[model samples]
Target: MDYIHLNEMEFYGYHGVFAEETKLGQRFRLTLSLAVDLKQAGETDELKQTVHYGEVYGLCKDVVEGEPKKLLEAVAEQLASRVMEDFPLIKGVRVLLVKPDPPIPGYYKSVAVELTRGIFV
Candidate 1:
């Protein structure tokens, strides 16, 4: 299998457990690794033979900005599901959703949720 990785994608979003957090919004970073068979594309040298990163990025942005969720787990799940649904060639994905500089009083730089989905090899 081959992999296409998109790392440290940062976006500003409104998602949190607190009402103020939701209203104020925060920055979220996403890192994703998509697993797929790239042999066909490598051999054929055709765009149609592989997953398009531009398309994937657009889909991810839509998912990120669409609505606010209370939990990062929920966001990760939805994003993973969407990736599978949108790109049939991908066998699976590893998603990391990070909340940087959260509105916490204590010393916390960020919080993150990492998830892997789809069938195992």
Candidate 2:
């Protein structure tokens, strides 16, 4: 099917395995691809026929900035779960979570995890 994409959503949170990491927190970037049937919305031109992306953005902000998870995988899971729960038209979700900076001693753009959940998976 069809897709609605929300890209490069940024947030700050404490999410890491290290002690300092949990205390200091870091920036996170999230991207969501919502699998949905947009034909109804396109045809009817009704807001309810499609997923409201504004609500989705708030939901992503809450999950990414709310809790401290040791792994990006867990964060991705939570986000995917919520999207499926709150939006009925959303058949599935693809969550891409990025940790812009980590305590790891290396040179890289970032560390990230991608999760696919529900019918879209």
Error of 2 at 63 (Å): 0.7
* Tens digit per residue, CA lDDT, model 1, 58-77: 88888777799999999999
**Candidate 2 Cα outliers beyond 4 Å, as residue runs:** none
Query: Residue 27 of candidate 1: its Cα lDDT?
Result: 82
Candidate 2 TM-score, true structure as reference: 0.96
Give the whole-model CA lDDT for all candidates, comma-separated. 0.89, 0.91
How displaced is residue 30 in candidate 1, in Å?
0.4
Lowest-sum lDDT 10-residue window in model 1: 101-110
Worst 10 residues of 2 by lDDT: 112-121
For each candidate in turn, give its C-alpha RMSD to the true structure in angstroms.
Answer: 1.2, 1.1
TM-score for each candidate, following the candidate numbering = 0.94, 0.96
lDDT of 2 by residue, 1-121 (tens): 9999999999998888999978988899999999999999999999999999999999999998898898888889999999999999999999999888888898999989988887774
* Candidate 1 all-Cα RMSD: 1.2
